[model samples]
Target: MSTESHNAENTGSNDSVVETSNLAGSGDFLIVCEHASNYIPPAYKNLGLDETVLKSHVAWDPGALAVAQALSKALDAPLVEQKLSRLIYDCNRPPEAENAMPAQSEIFTIPGNCNLSQADRDVRTKTVYFPFREALATCLDHLQARGKSPVVITVHSFTPVYKGVKRDVEIGFLHDQDDIFAKELIKTFAAETDKFVLRLNEPYGPADGVTHTLTEHALPRNLRNVMLEIRNDLISDQESQQDMATILAQAILQAEKTLGKHKNHTAPTTKPIKTGN
Candidate 1:
């Protein structure tokens, strides 16, 4: 479903409506971003935090949504994104996980999420989280039904400083017990002319048991997929975002050539799927 109007507060002139939109493409790829916004609707009232806390990483990944938007336009792929704060309901995490509704994200207390009962959690999950995920699944299904099983690429951005230490790796790939797509993409990216010093999984890895939407949908179908994490500093603005998109787009094209097409139903006879770092 196309989201026309967004009642979110003004963060900047570039801020656009944060809802799921499908930019249908003839290419064999589908892109999505689960934690796309830091916007808290008027109803929530800043999650009862001070200005500093509201602007923290707890509110959202600093620049992920921007990268996803640029990548979607560059690659002409269908894009899906969440409309609320990850602290409200982490679309990337399983609903039952303890950290799903974190009381403290890194170092900020989510005062608005102090003690949510099962019913309270259920309300947000049913209302916001499920719809966002459904939108992604629907878009993928639409393509698959048309004899095109698109490669899934989940985009995200990470903070440069997590408590004071600086994170140098500009890109990371996260995958659970599977690395068919992640490994190939990482290798392809490293060897490209761009020569991205991509991290295998520097910031975070799938073994953290942080169940992302990619794991929920793409992996089960055995579809080629990868979770990309770029350092937030690299995508804090349009110029940076576009550069990252170009770098990623090249890597994706290389993966398509090396891994082969998605049309063939047979599974690849590669090395056993291993968990990425």
Candidate 2:
């Protein structure tokens, strides 16, 4: 699903910059993976990074696409994903975001992103950002046109250790302005007999500008949304990815029932979920 397209006019779901699939799935949910690929298109000269850095989480969320695809299949929901390295254009970020094309990520310096003019940024906005946004919007519009309001779910993965600091949070549930969906999700994980370090807004939160996708799509449409940030080490293989997706899918489906209470837009209390054993 590595995509490469330079034309801003290529805004369709079939566009090379983004990928949209599982359209035949139900409307209960719409899943998106913004940092799905690590492809640099052989152009940017690997963003002036080494092979290892390009393959690192700084380039993309390792094993996130697998989990997202599994969720899409399990929920029978449509999924959208960006197909280029985040170093080229972070689909989850707004065009004005500084890290949208970060010159440095963690400790690795992105030489390719350094010293970019406004024109260079504009080119990437048109080529990468627009296509991903349009694709997700198209999915939402399709569901809306069918008179179906689906909960928007975004999938992502974080490095186990970041900038030399070890992260104890195994899984993080983030919300935009809405906390109804997030509350139930965290509750489900906490209620489960199995132990997992699932918490609310750890490592990165809406305050860190990581909820841009949810704000842009779900908030405007008034859809229930939550972003899942899993530890990449937990999903390094197909078996682990599927296993994690199954547990998450069960929790997500069960949590959807709580949405009924919030139809009146009643904001409930957000109780913290204990994590990090």
Candidate 3:
């Protein structure tokens, strides 16, 4: 059964901004999808965006949640997701980051985000970001208390093209400070005969402040972690999302074997890093 935490209210309907699922999962993974929803509460006035724009990548990662749920089912892993549009407050970003509540995204300007006083931004943070953060922290603490050093796997999708430039990378494995898991995943994908167009960090990287969740929740605790960025077009449909989820779940399972519950958390000897976006 799934459990939800609600905050935003619209037209007398209870809307949840954070959700947790499969908490009693028997697997050793925690699946996170920060950009899971595009549902904007009436509070921001759609962040002053058009309907089409609100449904675009800037609002949320289209198929990321589908894939994340698939992965959770495939691996019997626990999952957590945010249900509000990232334009409100990107859960993946700390409140201090500029893009946490972006004033502009791509060529489109965010009128609601512009000229915001600290109090205005803080309201969004309190409403959306903090609850999600606490939920994740509680999940991790519970798992650790149960003697499970769960692997942190965050799923996301990047637009195939950005600013009119077509991206060549089909999958990107990103890591923050911890590189062993990402390197192993790269190796696994590289060995695949199908040969996916992959990279270490393609559309984004730690330098871009995309690793805030990883650093905030995983790094300090010394957990194996990797952020998977799939090209949105690849997983645009349910079948494709499941296919990609199957592929990722297998890779993660294999990578876990290589690490073998490394209580010491030592990096396994692996090939040289060559694959990149």
Candidate 4:
């Protein structure tokens, strides 16, 4: 079920948490945008930060949702996204992680998230984290019922500079220990496009704990998966987002074809692996 409309409604200052589009698409690919929106649901009062911070990359991946939506259209794939800001509760992180409700992200401190009581943490987990997980699980279950195994592609964006240091990679394909799917994508992108710098785990890696969603949801099931991180500056607008999506969509399609040819020869690991950025 696509919760595009109802999932955008947050009653009584509560967050909607999860939003999905193209939920019934038949393609054997699933697109996920964990930091899609920067919405703070009014209850947190912008997490006690200014409007600029709310719009910054610290709150959300600036253009990840647009790229994911474009990919959903391009590939006829289902897209599931978190509707609230990561400051509320990072959907990509496990609840036990310290940054799950980060007191500080990058250099800015999240005043609202500081010194949280156990009850406050639990509420955020129950309201935001659990719902997001359930939504993705439900979607995956539906696809499995149809005998369709999906290649999960997570879309994310990173700032061009981190703590005043510039990052050289324009695009990053992040993966955990199971790098088969990510490696295939990297090879395809390297061969097909030279417009931007591409690398494997550049700005962030599994050590950054950014691959929690993939590790928790896809790895155990042995689902082919990859996390694509575009430099935020590269996809700051509609045109750029569309361009990146087209480039990524082509690469993913080509990689899927390659995976198909080697399906019988290789299989993805089913064991839960250590997570990453």
Question: Please, what is the TM-score per model?
Answer: 0.86, 0.89, 0.93, 0.92
TM-score of 3: 0.93
Better of 1 and 3 by lDDT: 3
Candidate 1 wrongly placed segments (more than 4 Å): 1-18, 193-196, 265-277
> What is the lDDT for 4 in model 2?
27
Candidate 3 local lDDT, residue 243: 86
Error of 1 at 38 (Å): 0.8
By summed lDDT, which 10 consecutive residues of candidate 1 come out lowest?
Answer: 4-13
Model 4 is weakest, by summed lDDT over 10 consecutive residues, at 5-14
Tens digits of per-residue lDDT, candidate 2, 1-277, equal 2222333442343436678888767648999999998887655678778898888898999999999999998998998888888888898899999999999899988999999999999989988898788888988898878777788899999999887889998999988667778888988867663567877887788768888898899887778889999999999999999998998898888888755632344322344333322
Return the candidate ranking by lDDT, descending: 3, 4, 2, 1
Per-candidate local distance difference test = 0.71, 0.82, 0.85, 0.85
Candidate structures ordered by TM-score, highest first: 3, 4, 2, 1
Residue-wise C-alpha lDDT for candidate 3, range 124-193, written one tens digit per residue: 7887888899999988887888888888999999998899999998899998677989889878766653
Segments in model 3 whose C-alpha atoms lie over 4 Å from true places:
8-13, 192-195, 266-277
Tell me the tens digit of each residue's lDDT in model 4 across 86-108. 99989899888989999999999
**Tens digit per residue, CA lDDT, model 1, 86-180:** 87777788778767777778867788888888987887666566666667677778878878867788888778888788887778886665567
Evaluated at residue 212, the lDDT of candidate 2 is 89
